[model samples]
Target: MHLSVENLTFGYGSKPILKGVRIDGIGAGKVAAIIGPNAAGKSTLFKCLAGILKGTGNIFYDGRPIEAFRREEITKHVTYLPQEGASNAVLTVFEAILLARQFSVSWRVSDDDLVTVSETMEALEIADFALRYLNELSGGQRQMVSIAQALVRNPDVLLMDEPTNSLDLQRQLEVLSIVRKATKAKGMTTLIALHDLNLASRYADQFVVMSDGMVYASGRAESVLTPQMLEDIYGVHAEVSIDSHGQTVVTPMCSARNRIANRRPEYAQLAV
Candidate 1:
C-alpha cells in the first residue's frame, strides 16, 4: 500500500466532525480531490493525514501508523501546503523554497536535495522569478512558490488546500496541469481540497464530496457527480449533460418556484 488511513475519527474538544473514516484504497500516481463547502471539515481531514493534528483510529502511510512516525520522518514522506493566508513568509521565492531542505534526509542538504529543489523550480516554471520576494509577487505567483516549496520535499503524498484560490482561468488550469504531470511523473499521490465543481470534474482522478462533515460520495468523477448530488449538496436543480468528448457539464437551472412564477401554466397553454 502506498498510503492508507483506516477508521480516522477526529474532532475539536468534544465535538466530533469525522467519524470512522477509512481510506485504504489509495494507490500511487493518482490525484485524489477532497471537495466540500466552507467549514465542512476538509482542512481538518488534511491535517489528520499530515499528522499535524492528532485523531483516533488508524492513519497509515506506507503501511505504518503516521502518528508513530517521527515528525521529520513523516516530513520526508508527505507535504501539505495550506492556503496562502497562512503563509507568514518574508523571504524571496527561492529562499522560501530552499527552506524545504530543513526536512531533508540529513540536517544538511546533500547535493541531491539542491538538485531536486532547482529541478522543481524549473518544472514549476518559476525559475525566472526565483529571486523575487513572495509578498511582492502576485497571488498567483505566491501560490506557485508555495507549490514549488511543497514539491521540493519530493514526497510520496502531497496535500494542498485551495490550490487555485488566487489565479486567473489560464493560470488555474496551468497549475492543475503542472500538478497532474508532476505527480504522474513521480508516481506520487496527491489530495487537493477544492470548491470549483467544474475544475474538480475535469481534473481529479477521484472525487470525494463532503456534506455535513461526512462523505456524501466518493468515486470516479462521472460516478460521483450526479444531478442528485448537485441537488442534495448544492440545493439546486441542474441538468447534467455529457458532450461527445465525454466531458460532463452541469447546467444548473432555476428553482421550481421561480420557473413556475415566471411561466404561468394557463398563459403557456394559450400561447401553444
Candidate 2:
C-alpha cells in the first residue's frame, strides 16, 4: 500500500502547524524520514496520518480516503510511537509489550499474541529486560520497551517520532536496523521523524524535509539534503557530500545569520 497526503493543513486556534503540505510516493516496505528544523510539524503530520488528530486534507491509503476507514480499522492498521510517553506505568517490560498486543486480541490472550510479543522484544534486543519494571529502567531502556510495544502490533503503517531519542549511538543504530528489517519483511510503510540528518540518509528510502509547516523538499537524500537547502531551511552553512558508500553526509560549518535571504520560493517546488 501507498500513503499520500495532499493539501494537508492543521493549526491551533489561528496559528497553523501544517500549511497545505503534499507528500507522495510513500509505498509499502519503504521507510520515509520526516526531517526538518524544530517545530516543523513532523510530529503533527504523523498524528494526522495515524488518525490521532483530525486535520484538513485528503489522506489516501492505496487511493482510498483516510475517512473511509472506521476507527477500529485505523487502529488495526496504523501504529504510532510518539516522541514521549508515560514511562511510569507500573508494568514490567514483558507485560507492557503484551498489553500493546492485547489491543488487537480478545480478553483472553492467545498463543499468537504471546509469541508475537516475545519475537518483537527479541528483535529489538530488549528480551533480557522482560522481567524489569518500566519505572526502574533507564530512559533508553524505556524507549526500547516502547518500540517493542509498537512493533508487536504488526501494523501496516508505522509512524515513529524520534524512535532514537535517549538511545546511545550503538542502540540507535541497532534499533533502526531492526525497524528497517521489520518494515521490509512485513511490507509496512514506515515514517520516522529524525533530527540526525546522517542517520536519516542512511536508513530512509525517501526524505520529506519540512520547514515552517510546509514541505520544503521531498525526494531522495542526495536531492533533498543539499547545502543550499540546508542553509535555506535550517539557516546552517553546511557542506553536503556523498561518502565512499554513497551516503549523504551533512557537515554544518556555521550558521548563516542572514537566513531570510536564503528562503527562496523555488525550493518549495522541489519534490520526487
Candidate 3:
C-alpha cells in the first residue's frame, strides 16, 4: 500500500493550522518519522490521516481518496496510537487489546484473535500486566498497552504519536526496534511523530520534517537533518555528523539567538 496526502488544509474554525500540506508517498513496510518543533501540527496531521479529524484535502491510500471510504472501512486499514493514552477505561489490559481485534470480527472471538492479542502483549513485553486494569497502571505502562492495542488490529498503516513518551531509555530502544521489525514483517506503512531527532534518525527509513503546519523537509534523515535545516527551522546551532553505526547525530551547541547576541551587542536584548 502507498499513502499520500496533497493540498491538505485544516484549521481550528477560522484559524489555519495546516496549509496545503503535501507528502508525495510512503510505501508499505517502511517507517516514516514525522519530526518538528513544538506546535508544528505533527499531532494534528496524524488525526487527519486517521480520520479522527476531517480536513480539506486529498488523502489517498493507493491512489484512492480516503474520503470515498466509510469510517469503518478506514479503521480497518489504519490504526492510530495517540501521544496521551486513555486511562479511563475500566477494562483489563488483555480485554482491551482483545476488544481492539474486534473491528472486523462478528462478535465471536476466534483462537486467532486470542493468539494475536497474547503475542502482541508478549512482543511488547506487557504480558505480565495482562490482568491489570488500565487505570491502575503508570503512564509508561499504559502507553505500552496502547501500543499493544494498536498492533493487535493488524492494520496496513500505523500512526504513532510519540510512542516513546514516558518510557525509559531502554524501553524507548526496545519499543522502536520492535515497531520497526513489525513494519517489515507485516508490510505495514508506519508514521511516527517523534521529537527525538537522534532516535528518529536511527529507526526511521524516511523523515518528514514539519514546521508551522507545513512540510519543511521530507526524505532520508541523512539528507533532511542537515546543519542548515537545524539552524533555520529549529533555531539551533547544531553539529550534524554520522556516528560509527551510520546514524545521523545532531548535537546542539547553542540557541541561534544566543549565537547572534554574543557577536552583535544590539541583539543581546533579544537573547535575554
Per-candidate RMSD, Å: 3.7, 6.7, 2.1
| TM-scores for every candidate against the unseen true structure | 0.87, 0.92, 0.95
Model 1 backbone overlap count: 0
Cα-based lDDT for every prediction: 0.80, 0.90, 0.92
lDDT of 1 by residue, 1-272 (tens): 27776778888889988877776556789888888778777888888888888988888776778867898777778888898532557887777888876764457867887788788888778899888887788878887888888888778898999988887888789788888887898888899898887787777888888776677778888888787888778766788887676777778797745556557988678768
Once fitted onto the true fold, the runs of candidate 1 whose alpha carbons sit more than 4 angstroms away are: 104-106, 255-272
Which structure among the candidates has the greatest TM-score?
Answer: 3
lDDT string for model 3 (2-83, tens) is 9999999999999998989999999999999999999999999999999989899899998999888898999899999998
Model 2 Cα RMSD, 1 decimal? 6.7
TM-score of candidate 2 to 2 decimals: 0.92
lDDT, candidate 2, 81-159, per-residue tens? 9999536888999998898876544567889989999888877888898998999998899999988888889999999
lDDT of 3: 0.92
